[model samples]
Target: MRLTGPAGLATRAVLAAAISGMVLAGSFAIVAVMAVAGGMILSAYGSDLLGFVRITPPQMFWPIVWLLCALGATGLFVRAIVRIIRTERAAFLERTTPLSETTMAETSYIDSSAERLARQVGIATPTVRIDSTATPLAYTTYRPDTSIINADRDETPVIVLSTGLIETLSQSELSAVLAHEIGHIANDDLRLISVLLMPLIAAETLTEDEGRTSNVFELCGHHLSFIALIGVGIFSRGRELAADRAAAVMTGEPAALAGALETLDESATPKPTADLRDHARSTNAINVLPTLGPANSGTGPRSTHPSLETRLEQLRSLARG
Candidate 1:
């Protein structure tokens, strides 16, 4: 397979998978602990569980408190899992125009770019899509593998571009953006980000209404989500830079991407592509640019992407090389 970046897409994807596994497991463990703790605490007071091992005052007190925490965490974990299984979609998504339904207006410009770039990357052309929104946006989202397994059972990735993006960028610059997104598919980034984001989504959903009333176990799960978020952020930035390199190498036009990044940030009136209340973290993880403002955007280690200047410099370096 063709390598996409310094360590190659396979290697980077492996790292992201490993991190995702850890995050998933860690969050579950916290919930399991919460369950155990909660059971022990409940048993201590009035329940019959563990009443056989009648440990004395102070020692029993600490154990009881710990047990309650574990019990609560476990409950939250189960609820989250159930919700995920039932809902299927990890998070709410904005509507996107699918390939068959895509209008002819800008199809020539966007689809042709995607078709050409996918060929260069040796991947099947993805379903290029448009989101009917005013905000400039670009992101890759996963499609579930529902059809009977064939030799080509690969879940087709979707590249979504906002109306504002199409209106704002020149064809070359938009092509660069398309190349960058196609690079994500070439590098297996869509699945990686989706897997890495599970815990964060679970945490947010778990605490959506809890507010101050959230218990220690819930808090633990929330805190563990941060670790997952950080992991996602680091790998996300790596993939972003790698995709930049891939775009430049594939298109032989790093300046085009650099210019697109500049124009997106320098927009006279920047509109958010995702609701900060519900979807900012989700969108920011995979969007071309972090939809949230800088405070919570992918500008830092805690967010999903690197700074605009960082990405621009990467393309500049690629161009120079």
Candidate 2:
């Protein structure tokens, strides 16, 4: 689950290459814009404008300005996403009830299973919370960036479950779900996906405020972000498959996980346009069950998780073997 072997190396390479690709794409996009803009200016004003003095040591001022602008936009892009992450997480937390207030009497197995599975994998037992809302939902969260001086992130990742999920699933099925989430914790899927999400969020921001773009630098950032989003899509789906596989292995009950998935699939009838909980839509990537009907199996780079069919097929294979 932690990404080892040739598969691990390949995943690391993909991640590194994706980030590098964004940087290169941004640089090239900016350069191309500069080239086009220069050509237009030269054509319009003729050689007379060239007399304004090109090619002085300090005359590289425009280039430096462009570089600084690009850097500034990058900082802004990152900052915007950081705010978004914090806000969505806050919204999610606000809507969910803590475990202390919930029916803990019914969930003793939840703690035991989480502790045992996490310990088996040498990870700290994740903190589990309950959402009172009845819409079936489940996800894991890791706050590695929560606090630099006193972060207990690796030691205390979180798993959130809705009362709907608890009431809907049997104990064994819930254990399978817990095992699956622990797989995500062990694999560090949340943080890794968060990295991949950066460019997409930047691109999304640009789309929302497209008219605000007054320069080429911002345009370059948009282009590179869309480019990086493709890689993110590919990796996102792969992580789901990895987590599922890890869950099956860890629990030694591919069928139980499979049954849980089937139950969730049945209840997921017609994805809601607006979930009862705020920001629930945004939390899909980390959720145990996705919102849409997409059966994407990492075959399409645009998908975030494997479809139910794809996942069930794998679990069925494991069961057969």
Candidate 3:
């Protein structure tokens, strides 16, 4: 079946859920085994406690301990991973200080155009920032309002455009890109993506140290990371398509988006000798355009974004309509 409509989305959602469940179950199994093993060690040593402090409970309490431990570990993992990502983003912005909001604010033309487009998209004019990188890139992020202490307010979305993108794309193409990002914000995709990343983040923590897997529990946890990545990829691809459709409708310029994608595809084509593997991977993971260069040819299956050809074809269909 050609799964690309509501049915396809449902199927992908189901697959993501199944994969997530498998990963969680595997993780719980590991925790249970470790809890049991620790209990056995304590019992063998005739110790009525754990770590020589907390009193060890009966066999029935081991399961409760495992659940609590797993929950605690998962919570910490999510917090740590989110913090790390935030730290890295902050560091990048700091290092590229010349491209900050104050710097871009001086560019009245871009600011005006973005404001106009933001109105057309039916959302607040997002704070616009520029990145000094030569590689063409654009993305959006949402930071919830922190002013009211605990107000149930919407997030303040920010749209970031790279220097290369500003210099390369035509005005219409640029507008199309911004529209796509606005679509992401309007759909509350950032929150959805953050929630989806929890399982993957936990899996990533478990697999961080390759040599740390000393037992079956660790091994299973490590393997579950790959499964979580698969689920992540599935949902990400669908989200990208949804964003594309939103952009096309909002901009009434599907062809412009296609043109922008074509240009980015050319820029992303890796040089034979350039070590852009990591950059390409990151770009494909988050950027609006998939860097379909020579360095990433074999990523057809694992890529977070759909193929350039696929995206272009979809846009072309939109254009025809």
Candidate 4:
């Protein structure tokens, strides 16, 4: 799918929060452990130097308190990392499901269309897959196949379009949508986005493991790793908008892309109030919209794409020229 501005921003924000949470947990652990260690050292040696190496009540009480707090923070961090993994896994599963029963016939039609378009555009044909969800969406995926790899040939990219999206748009509009995704491939935007976000993913995984460790030193390290993840979230939204623009240019039919946006807007289902509230809390963002916005308007901190109205406006503007 075209990474709309809001979607990119949301992704970056999630990465950032993961990083921040990890860093905070790590810092708390380190400080707590150091305090505990210092207390123990003083209790062990202070009496010897002063000829009264006796364990005092206050000294013993404070070390235990510090250790307890450190353990609690570590638990909290572990929980947060587990939460991130579950959410990420769900999203990945949704994207990678094999196009089997969802829309076999519709997928075949689109795959045919994509091959035609590929030939027309003078690019190698891409294998197309369909996702059955009614939510209008499309995206391109590329992987280097070792079996097919040759020193003289470039690895091929794969394209996927949702059957719901194909049914929603006209033939011309579908072509425009395909072109937009193709633009991503042409610009190597997918690889770029993946590479840019890899650090955040790694940090997230690290925090997940380290946060679980009981050692105060390891727990402290988990919190320190999240700063980079937060940085990833802040910038992701802008990149999505850029990709949309790239798609429009590649298709040379801004109105078709605009129409596609309108179709997605209509297809979106309403989210329940409880779900919206839950999302807000989980994401730690204020004024987040319940639905994905169109290309141009209604963007918020948590939105993954721009509003439909805004996207349509840009498309119409381009079409007029």
Indicate the residue-level lDDT of 83 in model 2. Answer: 77
Candidate 2 lDDT, tens digit per residue, 1-321? Answer: 263322763565387456746664665455555655665454446435554767233555455555665566556555665776665556566666667667655577887899999987888788888877666788876443463223345457678898878888988889899988888778776666656555555454445444455565567556655566566656666677777888888899999999999998787676554663345334655678765455432445555667778889999999998
What lDDT score belongs to each candidate, Candidate 1 first? Answer: 0.70, 0.67, 0.63, 0.51
Specify the poorest-scoring 10-residue window by lDDT in model 2.
Answer: 143-152
Estimate, for each residue in 97-210, the C-alpha lDDT of model 4 and write its tens digit: 454445454555566666766665456776566655554556654443212112122656656565557787887777777776665555445544443343344344444463
Give candidates' CA RMSD values in order. 5.8, 5.7, 5.7, 10.0
Top TM-score prediction, candidate number:
1
lDDT of 1 by residue, 139-255 (tens): 877543322112133667678888778888888899999998988888776656666677776666555454443676567556756677777776787888888888888889999
Steric collisions counted per model: 13, 0, 0, 33
Q: How much RMSD separates candidate 2 from the native structure?
A: 5.7
Which regions of candidate 3 fall more than 4 Å away from where they truly are? 1-7, 46-106, 143-153, 205-222, 271-283, 291-301
Work out the TM-score per prediction: 0.77, 0.74, 0.73, 0.52
Better by TM-score, candidate 4 or 1: 1
